[model samples]
Target: MAAEGKINPMHQFTINQIGPKLEIAGYNISFTNSALWMVLALVVIWLFMLGGMKRELVPGRWQMAVEGVTGFIRNMIDTNIGPEGRRYTPYLFSLFTFILISNLLGMLPLAIVPGFHAFTTTSHFSITGLLALMSFAIVLVVGFWRHGFHFFALFLPKGTPAFMVPVIIPIEIISFLVRPFSLLLRLFVAMISGHILMEVFSSFIVNGLGSSSAIGFGVSLLSFVFIVGIGALEILVCALQAYVFALLTSLYLNDAINLH
Candidate 1:
């Protein structure tokens, strides 16, 4: 049995089986919360788009909200990537919506306790890794689509001397491979850290107040107030992280498309 006062927020990262397990080579194939959240993110994006499409001109509250979000992403892409990169708007928009929704949804007290008790997909490295891989794939595809074989020349900066090519080229290649790692780390760390802090503080308040009479109650009250403030900050973080992720993705695409 679990301890009465102990909290286990990290349990959110567990993978619960949904069906008969299948062995693929030597790997265990099973359904998990990570997969569930990925699907939920996609569904949320699809529904938002569909709602916006349904009310193209005579917009309702939902439509207006959807348009405002799309417009913000449009401006972000335009500013960072320019008109030539407008073709990638759908992808950028999708990425932003999916992440934003996932982050916010994780904050909500849902049937499956978002971001807690085997319910958090965003905390899993595999999910973040796949997302980073997708972003890299987009960069590569767009680069090849725009510049063909000439894109390889981007590794060699124009001012580089022949003697320095040996040194700089390998460095550039490593940097290119590390792009996905950076993206994965940024998103994963931000999301996981925020939720973990919130959980820890909340558990503190619950346990602290429950343990004593007056002083504990006062301390718990203070902790609750602090948690509320942190909640607001987390909202900002959720939106900012989503925006930063999409913005950096756009910048990366721009680099690939307009490679030197």
Candidate 2:
């Protein structure tokens, strides 16, 4: 139980070790809550994907949903990356589903269950950082592969003043380098901020009941209503963030593929 006199809103984000740590070579890797949640999120995603596999004359709701998502991503890629982007469906689709599930899972009130709670992987910088790096790597590898050494030319745009080449080149290079960091911060901050607000309001409910006063109870009721609204907003944020991440990813791929 939480301490009687104080509530630690940040405590929910803690990563607890679930069992004995194992050493592989010189490094110790302990299974943790964050890792457990990630596995759970993947399982949920896998089950949902299986929903798309039912072959029938009339499609079920699950199959329709799966088809809808598939079409949306396909259209997004075509609009953003053109025909060549078709080759990237597997990566883009997986990215969208993983982040989408991870965000939604974190919004669930499952903390009461032992060894389970919504672990917002996107909120953790480490996870986001790794994703950002992978995105960057994809862009770098594909850019160079397609255009050879000319990929370096992306740093300088056409029609620029010859005299400003040095300044503009470095600036563009810095901006390109910052794409992953930008992606990392946008999703991480949104997830963390929304969850923190939910946590704070939840504590208000506890503190309200403890007071045993009419005004406290009334305020607690108000907090409850507000928290519900926040929860709905967080749900919207989950979908929006996932879409934005995928959209930005498509844009990045366009830049890499066409140097736009």
Q: What would the per-residue lDDT of candidate 1 be over residues 141-232, giving only the tens digit for each residue?
A: 88888889998977898899999999999999899899999988888898888777877777778778887878878878888898898889
Show where candidate 2 strays beyond 4 Å. Answer: 113-116
> What does each candidate score in C-alpha RMSD?
2.9, 1.6
**Model 1 alpha-carbon miss at residue 170, Å:** 3.8
Error of 2 at 164 (Å): 2.8
Instruction: State how far residue 252 of model 1 sits from its true place (Å).
Output: 0.7
Q: List where candidate 1 sits over 4 angstroms from the true fold.
A: 1-4, 19-26, 111-118, 160-167
Top candidate by TM-score: 2
For all candidates in order, the CA lDDT equals: 0.80, 0.88
- Clash pairs, candidate 2, are none
What lDDT is reached at residue 37 by model 2? 83
How many clashes in each structure?
1, 0
